[model samples]
Target: MEWAEFTEQSHKGRASWTAIQPENKRTATDNALALKEFFQRFPEYQNRKFYITGSFTSESYGGVYVPTLTNLVIKMIQNGTLPNVKLVGMAVGNGELSADQQTNSAVDLLYYRGMLGMQQFDSLKSCCVDNYDQPLTYCNFSQFVVVDDFGNLSPNNNTNDPKAIQCGKLITSFAMDSVWATANDVYNSYQDCYNFTSLSSGGLKGEAGRRTWKAIMGSKRLRASVQQSQDLQSMFSTGSNPFVDQGALYNQGSTDAMGGFACYMDSATQVYLNLPQVRKALHIPDSLPPWVDCNIPVNSQYYHQQNHDMTPVFQSIIDSGYHLNMLIYNGDVDMACNFLGDEWFMENLAGSVYKFNLLSDRFAWNYTRGSFLPQLGGYVKSWSNYNTTSIDLLTVKGAGHFVPTDRPGPALQMIYNFMHTGNYNNSVPFSLDPQPLLPQFAAPPKPSFTRKQADRVWSLPGVTYELNFKQYSGYLNGVPGNYLHYW
Candidate 1:
């Protein structure tokens, strides 16, 4: 098929695409009814906390996953511009070829070999692993972290996967501002996962180089060959380079009839994976940058300055007699930020260290993973339960860096349990309003001083202490004393 032909085919995309729109365009009257419906369904949210998040909120994956090198390679093969590369062999399996065909396993191996940096090829090949079979581990060497204010995280090793990492960092770090902070709140606690020592002079440069990125970088190149995509079925006379490490090509796994060795993805598949991502890419005509751009019109270089953005706002919310939950969730597949970062954030919350020791409580539910899934999210009750006020780590099952996108069901369920019962329940239809958590932790009355004493201490003009020590802060004219200290 010609590029022009594929372009023409793409025109019909909008006819079938999904579009999410607000009810009645969300006017005051519409929102009033929405409010009415809200109260009708769950009245507690009225003037209470609410949250919505996902890739849509983060604006990650703009362009969806198109323009990706893999996607481009796919398109090139589809157009027949890439020679000797059959586009059809992309996703098709090398499982069991018929008498009439042989497998292009080598090519498939090569593609995954490059795309997945440190991933094991054997595990990757198992991705076509039979049903109920173990598929490849996307990034198996990853670790979980529990550190300072950043909470738990599991960031992807390859920073070059900028689209996935930066965009995730930007969105996860800031997108929930309205829910947690008011007007400019951001908190980024994600950490880099790759080992830095692997790059140094005396590090993995020698022996590890075999598995080190440098070795992989040195020994690979695809020999691009082109043929008319329209005339895809034609058999070429030339065949194998039996001596080469990557054997001669044959159709591997993709559905396209074009018989070249290739990795190709068309535009439609991308939209199906993430339509909103495509929309965002289209919106940013000049630069579909991943993560929040430095020039995001804020602190310029002070971009990931999330701590700066969030700390004061958190204090403000505490001051306003409101409850705030700073939650960080991660999807395991997301090779970007890991849950280790979220662990870091939680441990160091409120500028100090905390720990949630693995509880020996009898396991409550079936935390075991179901078929096709890997690890399920589980939580151990904090040792200091019935403890003091602070945010808690809320884990979701089967999620990735983009937790909401991957496991919105569990996430929403957790938040529902959070705001409603102040607990997380894995069970569906978990009891709502299990128990009211009317916060008894309101701000104490400000400290006071006699009129003359305040005048001497603060030196602010016209100080009048109308109320006594009853309204402690009457001395400072509503200037709140430090809740942790001034008392």
Candidate 2:
């Protein structure tokens, strides 16, 4: 998907790329036009209230696309181009608000979540502090890397230079890969799927090797000299290898494209979607292929045509005085799109789109049980107009990139409160505890292969290393229609 490319470009100031912006915007704009036409054909449906919602830039059309579409609909209704269609509220989660801010926050979040250790953090911090005069939290690591690669930390560094940006991306990719590999150790579960494992001594040795590579990469001279990014890609590649058994663990069902934090949902959803009865009931023909969660074609198109920042679109909507409620929230643990960056994106619009600097002070949103103490659920910072708060920035604790999928209870509660009362702060009352709301029975996936299996031998390319004990490797087709494997 060239995520690294987008990440690098975003870290620079330009945000959206001219190369992809036109096609992406046109795609979304055309869809909005088609939707308006459909509604026009059905006059009876146009009178009812409608609310719009989406997640990530894919569904949200760069996080601002749906709202932009809605705005167009509103304009059409006002000008008699279409029947009146009421769009009362709009919400987006873990979506792109600001490219630079998102990249900055993502790097910072890796540190916050213990993915990037203190050593890496210190290195990046020095690069940022010396070059940008900003803390690591706010600085663009990509730009910092570019300057650091050049042996200069000057404020006036040409971060946007194509060569510099590529250099920065390569270095950033190496550092991020090291951290991501190490992150698997702490999380245990593969980010793509629910396969869980504690690395064997051999795996630990591989991890140690990865660490050594990272330590060696800490040198700017060495880092800049290394021109090949395939090295970073291969570090985490899911190939048939005995030393690194990611192919057996995560690639069996091709579920490695999923996320960590929740296993049951991932497995169970696959089960439900692939059920023949369910598929038939949902109007699927037997001729069609089995159901998959993601649309790879669409994803690829979005990636190729992905460039819009959407922050400006958000500001445009806010400045339009639409009177519609807008909410932007995310899970705190999301490395894909961090909450802090979204907060920064929203806050930056305060003085520009909002008159009188509408953004209010941030506050913690605690979850309290009647007699017991309160748990910090997350944080909230609201943006106000003349006397009313319309924009909300919030976080869900212990959640990853997908908030609802990760912490459904708090997310639903927050949604209910915002929808019913239009008060984000009033959601999740102090008297209500969220512990009971989450799935009480969902357990983490247990590993089929234990560390004790480390001594078992496998026939592979490297050597005829022997196992004193017998070893077997095969896939386990679970009742949930997904595949798992062990070595």
Best by lDDT: 2
lDDT of 2 at 17: 30
lDDT of 1 by residue, 94-183 (tens): 011110010122122223425323343343333232421554423211111111111112223355654445433322222111111211
lDDT of 2 by residue, 107-191 (tens): 6666666656776565554445455445455665545442222111212235566555544553454334433334342222223
In order of appearance, the predictions have TM-scores of 0.29, 0.57
What's model 2's lDDT at 309? Answer: 58
Cα displacement (Å) at residue 141, model 1? 19
Residue ranges of candidate 2 with Cα displaced over 4 Å: 1-23, 30-49, 55-62, 125-137, 142-171, 174-261, 269-302, 351-356, 367-375, 387-389, 425-487
TM-score of model number 2: 0.57
Runs in model 1 lying further than 4 Å from the true structure: 1-321, 332-335, 350-376, 380-390, 430-487
